[model samples]
Target: MTWETVPLRSVARVDAVHVAPEAISTSDVYVGLEHIGRNGAIDETYYPAAREIKSSKNRFDGRHILYGKLRPNLAKVARPRERGVCSTDIYPILPGSSVDRAYLAHFLLSPEAVGFAAARTAGVNLPRVSWSALGELPIPLPPLAEQRRIAAILDEADALRLTAICRLRLFQKLEESAFELVLSVSR
Candidate 1:
């Protein structure tokens, strides 16, 4: 399939929100850089209640894709399920025009996109891709239906990978237990 391409800004709004402390309710959810996972995963448990944070943060709804801007190589980006606040290091991007949010999230996690961010990253120790640089990155634009289809396929692949990793860990634990039992018998 011939996938048309566009600048990242053409299909999405990056760093489009900033919320004052008082404006956000204590009950609101807060997503930090740690909450985002590699390859578009999100660890919801890592988030804190909005009241726990004192400084200003970016506001985002479920529609936005939360991305970790601090280290682009980590590929920390995800689509949240509810409205919330996130760290300044995490950009909440909202898809525009014919763009699919899920597709956009997957795209951000792609090697090419991650490389683009990594290349544009600034700073010595804490390298980061400024919002302006992120917006200028190139992105593929497929039809909305196709985008959803591609996203679904990618999601299934991700699920399979997670399952495989889980099984590997379980097997390792079983092996460790068996080894311990053998040592006890030898003693």
Candidate 2:
């Protein structure tokens, strides 16, 4: 039997959410809306740490896909590194190693999943994506090798984009410095 497509709940366990503290600390690693990128990469540095995070918040550390369960937040899914420690509002998805996390991440971050999550969101304030709805999400699966290959391509593209951004910023800084020096001398 080919399980080309499977419900997320089958390959994973969706935890009952534990609410985190109102604030974060350096000791506590927080996973908030900003940590995850649209491309499914987790920029850990972006997620600030607080001194303390509440225990009730979902603990997604190591090898799990981190998902922002709050409405527009669902669009920011990523696979966290250093496993364990995240904001109370962030939902952690631990994908079975058997399933390539990169592949699963792509699926979760897909437009389809975002729409699904949005439809089920409960709160009027933030349009929270319900865990049950998230769990029931159907994901497209591919073999491990294929998943890795896809991930690698995505990673390469990201690196190139970042490189270009740095170059652009550096040039801008140079221009500003030169202008400042010339203008200062003219004055």
Candidate 3:
């Protein structure tokens, strides 16, 4: 299949719905850059209630793909599982009808995209990728079905990698325990 390359703005838009602190509900979940893990994962435990937030925040639903504009090299991205408010530092991207949220999220996490954002970041301290710059990023577009298939494959690979890392950590812990046991017995 021939994939067409287009600017990210052509396939998605940044939903800049900033809700004032007073308008935000206490029960609303709030995600900050720290709440997002590198490469499209969310640190579910870190989200705070909106009541604790003092500034205006962007509102997003599960359909939006959250991209951390600050420190884009970290590739902090995620598909929110529920409606929530996020730091203005994050761009809540809403994929166009032709685009798939998962596919778009994976693409944004790609090395090319991360490099693009990193290179374009502005500011001496706390550098950030502006919405205009992010919107200009080139994206490879495939057929909807192909995009879904590709996303599924990538998801499976990511899952396998995580499992392997978990297993490796468990083995390391076991080794440490065995070494301590041997030392204690010798003593």
Please name the candidate that would achieve the greatest TM-score relative to the true structure: 3
Superposed on all Cα atoms, the candidates' RMSDs to the truth, in angstroms, are 1.7, 3.8, 1.3
Poorly placed runs, candidate 2 (over 4 Å): 1-3, 15-28, 37-51
Q: Model 3, 1-187: lDDT tens per residue?
A: 5689999999999988989998888677788988887757777776566567889999999999999999899998999998889999999999999888899999999999999999999997899999899999999999999999999999999999899999999999999999999999999
Reference-based TM-score of each model: 0.91, 0.76, 0.94
* Residue 129 alpha-carbon offset, candidate 2, angstroms: 0.8
In model 2, which range of ten residues has the least summed lDDT?
A: 16-25
In the range 10-113, model 2's lDDT, one tens digit per residue, is: 87765534545553345555666767677666666654444344455566666777778776444878776674566556767777765777777777777888
**Per-residue accuracy of model 1 over 18-111 as CA lDDT, tens digit each:** 8887787867788888877675666767556556678889998888899889989999999988888988898888899689888899889989
Candidate with maximal lDDT: 3
What lDDT score goes with residue 67 in model 1?
86
C-alpha RMSD in Å of predicted model 2 compared with the true structure: 3.8
